[model samples]
Target: MSGLLCYCRGGFEPELAAELGERAAAAGHAGYAVTERGSGFVRFLTPAGDAAGLSRALPWRSLVFARQKLRLLADLDAVDTRDRIAPVLAALQAGAVDGTLAPRFGALLVEHPDSDEARPLAGLARALGNALRPALRKAGLLAAKDDPRRPRLHVCLLAGDHLLLALGDPADSAPWPMGVPRLRLHPDAPSRSALKLEEAFLTLLDDGERARLLRPGMTAADLGAAPGGWTWVLQRAGLQVSSVDNGPLRQHVLDGGGVEHLREDGFRWQPPRPLDWMVCDMVEQPRRVASRMATWFREGWCRQAVFNLKLPMKKRWLETSLCLDIFGREAGLPLELRARQLYHDREEITVLAIPTGR
Candidate 1:
């Protein structure tokens, strides 16, 4: 059986590919890139041990993340295309599907001209709801029977006629207290490029994951936090934040509690004490950021970190590998790390790392 893997552009695909490459080189199994387009599809001839490791590393949470791409459309036609398609469509029409796709994600794709109309593509999206509805109801991915809670689910439609739908996954899970807050990027208007990106990022975060990453009473330091996007997230999470930037921050963020604006160079500024979290969204070269992160991690200046490394326009994969190597070797700290090019992000990759000792 062939195992399918989907990867987001700036996420861990390169690392995953590198891992797969090593496995293939060692005669674990043959691995190849099956399809590459907006998203990527990789196929691996499953080796017992290697497959197990992959399964362990890929938690359901990661599967739900925008960077990791969903693993769906697995050999749907392997046995009998018609046989598989029929049941899925029937389920959709019946509204028996569960999870976020009960309404069906990627149903929009069927409306596009490129897809074959004769293939019952429309029915397939509906079937996802039909087929998974029971499971979702049971697992609480949907509303509980007579439970007055309304939760918003976030769905990611991946490549290969597959879907990755998640409901209330903590990061994007909803029914926020005041309803989801509308963030205004421009002081005068409700819409701006940065605000839109923030909303998109929050939607991808899900409530639970957001809570974990952004906890109350935590102390955070933001490097290169001018105009404060990442800092805004941390402050809203109820963490005390010291924002380091020579540039100005949004007035609202500046007025927020648990927040202190420091007008200093990010690279040169140092926190008075170790912080719970350190976030950076600088525009400098990737190596410079990597070097600084390594120094902080090595010196135990921060317990956990989330930062972005801008990638060169060409040879993105190679560049990612190089940065990973620097962090792994130079940090001189045992670390648990995950990196991905988020949906709300462009031309750069986000890294979330936690020191192992902590």
Candidate 2:
């Protein structure tokens, strides 16, 4: 059976596999997931249907654990390093094209899992990627000029000399390697928590929405804002922030003068007036946080929000699904929501919600 391959954070093979298996089953392509511990990846094998078609059928946004999704096209075992590019090129020419779309690949991405054995292949990918692209072009497998709309070809080096070659729809797969960006922390930010919001913006919103929605002078509230990590992120984005927490904020955050320190409980506090945005990173049951976030939108307390939900030790995917479902119901009609396991989060996931209408 052909399979779908997904890249995720190390040690989360179980969550990624379970979520993919469940989602694949729900999509009418029942499958089983397999991965090794600390492998940093998972594969869902479907007994029926073409893998590319199955990948297209799955909703990319609904997946919480998967970072990059690829449709398995070929698997090369015991690659010859002396002339590694030759075998890979032969496989691509023969079978890597998307059967469903007769797709012409725009780019070739040579990737590897985050395992220690796979990390060394970064150099191999860099060396062979340049070699294989031209070989593909020479063989008429790729166009002379790239078309951004076309799918990307992926060649993933496994722990050994083996490799898994795949194709991914540009619309359905992450545009970045391992679905993570290398972002530097703001030197002046109060805490490292600021990275979550930065990544959320880059991953969740488009360029136009970001420019229009995050303009200077917009007002925001940061709940559980002690140490003011999220608040600093908001202020850096040029919003006036109300930092609500019983504990004091970092001295620099208070000294910045864009923040109003409020000694109040996040669960019970309300802004004196409606604000443009709200952010939360409190440690609490995901359900309680989701319910509160929904209430903020349901009553028009804020136009949009980015928050974190701490998950229990088990059934994290299921708990996340159920909580988001509850959030959707409580938020009512015309609401948009997205949740992701960011590189900066641990035992928690971040959520972004926007109300489309009344």
Candidate 3:
């Protein structure tokens, strides 16, 4: 079997499947998604030898629901438990012989579906990594050392006996294992919501963009900053923040002398002057939130912004498309907008927006 394998949050299989199908078709690829409910992964099946083309056509950054995207090389089934490495090596060698893969891969990533049923396989994945890395090098299928500029080989264990061999482009795929970043809650963070923003920065922005954009002494405002989770993240980045919310904020967040707690409704409170950044995490209707965010860009209230859109339980894809349209059309500026359903997010997706052309 051959296609593209997409990793996503467990319960969002349907959404990821829908997105894959639509995006693939839009990219002029004829494919069908094969997945089950809560599978945590989706396989977009294409005709033989078409996976490579599809992978090039659909860039990873364009996928909102997919945590990682890999081009399926081969899907092995009914492998013996004791000799699982043989089938994987065989698949990679076969692809190399056929010119479907490189002679040597730069890196090997062994992963599993992010579901409760598959969680137990994590240990097996690690063991396989240790056992297979040498075998891969001995077989001349892996480079002497890891190289970030070359293709990344992936082994995804669907079950003890079922696995998929795939290739990931280091330039386009997520850099983390299982497409999840290892983020820990900080002790100084007022609430767990801080992790959401941290993950957004890591996932949405590249290293160069982060260094260029988040300089110290920048001005920012955190809408609905009660308990000051997002505010805490911004202040830590050395941005002086106005924490706008009617509710009380954590005293430490305000004690940094960099954060000023403003008792006002987030939607109604506008920055007194153009600020460097504006972020909103208010739990309002998605359209209302999108519209307000659009107004910020339209009126030049902030240069860049990161916000969240709480999706409804049903028709999330439809809602996401409609809300993004409202935001883009209403903003009335060329904006660099990137959004994702982050690992820390539950039913909502986070968005990062920046106005273009000064």
Which candidate gets the maximum lDDT versus the true structure? 3
Q: For residues 251-328, could you state the per-residue lDDT of candidate 1 as single tens digits?
A: 877777678999999988888899888888888889878888888888878888888888887666677768877987
Note the residue pairs that clash in candidate 2: none
Rank the candidate models, highest TM-score first: 3, 2, 1
Cα lDDT tens digits, model 2, 1-358, are 6888888878778889888877777778878988987898898887874686678777566678877888888778888767777877677656554443335688778879876657888887777778878887887777788776888888888844688888777788788776667889989988898888998888777778799889899999999998998998888888999999999899988887789999999888987789999999999889999999888888778999999999898888889889999999998757788788888888888888876531
Q: What is the lDDT of residue 322 in candidate 2?
A: 92
Estimate the TM-score of every prediction. 0.63, 0.92, 0.97
User: Model 2 segments beyond 4 Å from truth?
Assistant: 98-103, 143-147
- Evaluate model 3: give its TM-score: 0.97
Best by TM-score: 3
The lDDT of each candidate is: 0.54, 0.82, 0.89
Off by over 4 Å in 3: 96-101
lDDT of 3 by residue, 1-358 (tens): 4688999998898888888888889988888999988889999987655777788888898788999998877788999998998988887777632265556889999999899989999999999999999999999989989998878889999998998887888988998999989999999999999999999989988898889789899999999999999999999999999999999999987778798889999999998899999999999999999999999999999999999999999888888888999999999999988889999999999999975532
